[model samples]
Target: MPEFAPIHLLYLALAIVLEIAANVLMKFSAGFTRKLPAMTAIVCALAAFTALSYAIEGIQLSVAYGIWGGVGLIATAILGITLFGERLRPSGWLGLALILGGVVLLKFS
Candidate 1:
């Protein structure tokens, strides 16, 4: 496997952060009565996807997307567990492990 340039990794990380931010904003906008937040959220989502597309130029789309999604799920789950006091049963842990294992396999395969 080739080592990714630092800049490329930065861009990829930015894309993921933007995507998560957009999703959070979108959820907020749904409960909001004003239009500005909703519109902003839409724009954020568009930008996030655009950034992701740019990152894909330097990385395989399958690898990028699989890592992005898998890591996102894991991170979000951890956040929920720690920040929101959400419970992760043994089955949930098993699922998370499976996802991470799948990602690792994809990275090597």
Candidate 2:
């Protein structure tokens, strides 16, 4: 794997945040029926992809995407529980743990 500059890591983190925000906005957009939130989600998704593209330049593509998706899934799950009153089964928690483990393994690999 290539050495990622601090700025690249920052961009990757921001991309993750933007992606999560886009998901939340897309949910609120109600299948893109609402104009403002839908547009915001589009913008967020575009920005997130752009940042993630930059991230892959410094980090390995597979590793960057693994960590990106894994962390995003965990964060989104937590946010869903808090914001939407969603429930997580024991198995769901275990799945989250597995995702974290996969990310760790990807990092070490």
Candidate 3:
């Protein structure tokens, strides 16, 4: 793995959290009809992007964004299934596993 500062990792981690929060808020916002959730979603999205920008200063943008997006996508999928009772078929599970593999490869690349 290429070396990266702790602060860069911190920023990337926060970016993933903020992005996940934004997606969850948007889901609860129900097409933005719910005012508070809609506004919070907007804020989270902005913060996520801001953190991503900072992360790229130390971490390569390709690596940072790939990890950020992959992890966020995986977490969101889990939350959707758990909290919203969404279903995933065998194909979906395979896709998630592929994403996990890609993320690990990206980290070591």
Candidate 4:
């Protein structure tokens, strides 16, 4: 298996973070009922997609997007658990594990 450079991983992680931030901003915009938040959401979405494209330069699109989505889901779940006091049952944990395992496989494949 080929190893990715640190910078490549950094870009990929940044892409994912930006994507998540954009999504969160979009949700906030829904509550504001104003144009400013909506405009900010559009800008953030564009930035996230641009970063994702940059990340694909050094990583396979499939692997990059898979890891991006998988890690994002996991992180969001954790945030929900901590901040929203959401609970995950055994089945949910199993599903999360499967998603993580898929991410590992996609990264190495």
* Predictions in order: lDDT: 0.76, 0.91, 0.96, 0.80
In model 2, which residue pairs have backbone atoms overlapping below 3 Å?
A: none
Off by over 4 Å in 1: 26-41
Winning model by TM-score: 3
lDDT of 1 by residue, 24-93 (tens): 5555576656577777777877876787787778888888788777876787677667755889899999
The digit string of per-residue lDDT tens for model 4 on 1-109 reads 6577677788888877876666566655777576777778778668767877888888888888899889978877776677658899999999999999999999789
Relative to the unseen true structure, what is the C-alpha lDDT of residue 108 in candidate 2, on a scale of 0 to 100? 83
lDDT of 2 by residue, 3-93 (tens): 6799889988999999899988888899999999999999999999999999988888898899889998899889889988999999999
What's the TM-score of each model vs. the native? Answer: 0.75, 0.94, 0.98, 0.78
Better of 2 and 4 by lDDT: 2
Clashing pairs in 1: none
State model 3's lDDT: 0.96
lDDT, model 3, position 106 = 94
Error of 3 at 108 (Å): 0.2
Clashes per candidate (backbone, < 3 Å)? 0, 0, 0, 0
Considering lDDT, which of the candidate structures 2 and 3 is the better prediction for this target?
3
Task: Return the top candidate by lDDT.
Answer: 3
